[model samples]
Target: MSAVPISEHVALVTGGARGLGAHIVRAIAAHGGRVVINYRRSADAAHALADEIGDSALVFGADVTDKDAVGVMIDAAAEHFGAPVTTVVNNALPDYSFNGDGRSHADNLTWTELDAQLRGIVGGALNTIQAALPGMRAAGGGRMINIGTNLVQNPVVPYHDYTAAKAALLALTRTLSHDLGPDGITVNMVSGGLLRTTDASAATPDAVFDAIAAATPLRSVTTPAEFADAVLFFLSPWSRAVTGQNLVVDGGLVKN
Candidate 1:
């Protein structure tokens, strides 16, 4: 639980309709934080989550890659919540999978795939950050959390394009921290390994999970709910002076 109540702040989680984003949204609400659930297409799921979260949760559908839509989302969230959004969790993943069963090898990899990721992750992050900056600045501060992956540090799966984009996002996180800190805003990242079961990782083999668990200090795979909790720390007053840090939450699968 956060020592400082974020109940007055509106926290936005992009792609919050399902997967890890969904869990993150629920956790934010559970901690008494007002939340905005941004979804690209998962309309039904978004609405269901809003109903589950009651009045504290607001659902908005917008493609994160679109600058105009993202701006609209930020404005609507502030209007609906009667306050500027103070925390942003950039968790919207483009079309990518962690199955490892069918992936492009180094020789067969193409720039197109990499471009897609850059467009999705880096582009989306930029669009959202730019759109939300004014409100965050006027409010005197904010927190921006980019959902990263341990694969960049460990390279356990060689998810080339995805890893590359996240690495780029991490760089963005650090640079933004330097730029945004003076405004009393904090920027950081939360990195996780291949999660147990998300739509993207559902095709992953059991043997791989067992191998990961066998080597991890916790002796278990990291769950979405468990990972979601770590995100709150950055938004909490406890991290008042913290910025430009990457918190890895993969049950010790990758130590950095």
Candidate 2:
């Protein structure tokens, strides 16, 4: 298989208005890919980011969990770029916080909470995948990189609902890898530990980050930029032969 350059792909990044999703957008643009930045409510941030990237970026608003909305967004992206989105980064996250002290334990975790997360994480991915299928098929090949969590593996904090949803995403990623392989679509995941700073992790105390960094081989908590790099790898031609795998980007914190 011939390797394709990042410049050859039009990419869509869900929740690309801020945080790690924003970083992923920047990374893809920096590497010469055109980006469709999808956001649900962070319109200002999304517009600001698209402005920063100039012509290489397009800002689209849609709730990833809404299949019809996602379909419309994908259609708009194709019309805007004059090409289908060949790379998708499933980075949209539902409202979540990483403050362990405030997290609900498994005993107190409600089914409603788990269901919400499943809809946001798994359902969102499913919507985007289905919406983008026709475009990907027409484009010949594509990349689908799902954002995951290291908590699914270690569960040190045991964020039961969040971990459970991401675990299911990983399962979905593998299943899609098999089903989509014939179509030349590679499905993979990039899981990160508590990133140093993101809206989701903003509530995390400094002490927790310090403690995590101290325990890591790199002596640092992963940054949004560092984690974004892994997403880039999965999107790049270098990963043409790679799929159905999860790359953990947590400063060697969780070696599995």
The candidate that achieves the highest lDDT relative to the unseen native structure = 2
- Candidate 1 clashes: the total is 0
Error of 1 at 188 (Å): 0.3
lDDT of 2 by residue, 30-89 (tens): 999999999999999999999999999999999999999999999999999999999889
Candidate 1 matches the true fold with a TM-score of 0.96
Kindly list the per-residue Cα lDDT of model 1 for residues 140-177, writing each as its tens digit: 88889999999899997788999999999999999999
Error of 1 at 203 (Å): 2.6
RMSD of 2: 1.1
TM-score of each: 0.96, 0.97
